[model samples]
Target: MPKSKFNVGDKVRLNKRAPGYYGHLLQRTRTIISIFYDDEKQGNTYELGARGRGGSLGFFRSYMLSGVSPAQASKIGRPKTKRSYKRR
Candidate 1:
């Protein structure tokens, strides 16, 4: 197992997706309620919670960056489409 970048009680935000229309993905903040890893502890995932009680869990939970900085979030993942050229 490896060290977790964030611990329980840490605050984080989901990386914003321009076409993200889900209400939950509306630039809200979440707290780390729990963290988990695979059986081999090779990969890590997080369980996020709202700021306070009476809150609900997010639909997208797994292998996501927590508390991503504005700069880092911008380029967190690969683009939806890859540019390919025909070899002639």
Candidate 2:
């Protein structure tokens, strides 16, 4: 796959089935705080908003950004088409 064009400050969301550390998953809208590529490490980094547990920081692979921003959330990968989706 090609590298994503997402930049810092862009809003984004996560997929329920998206992989994470320790066999866990997340599915929610979040902000893109940072993006990094580590050729030596052979991977990428994508930091997101804080988690629910006491404002814990959340980080995931760039692939987690498969979902779109809150602004375009309604028109992008929104599993529903019947109801009119609105950004929060």
lDDT (10s digit) by residue, model 1, range 4-36: 777777767776532365556547777778777
lDDT digits (tens) for residues 1-88 of candidate 2: 2375677777666664465552433555567667777676667777776643434246667655575735543456647657886999
Off by over 4 Å in 1: 17-24, 54-56, 59-63, 66-88
**Candidate 1 weakest lDDT stretch, 10 residues:** 57-66
- TM-score, each model? 0.52, 0.50
Q: Return the lDDT, model 1, position 22.
A: 53
The pairs that clash in candidate 2 are: none
Candidate 2 C-alpha error for residue 8, in Å: 0.2
In model 2, state the lDDT of residue 50.
Answer: 62
Q: How much does candidate 1 score in TM-score?
A: 0.52
Q: Could you say which candidate leads in TM-score?
A: 1
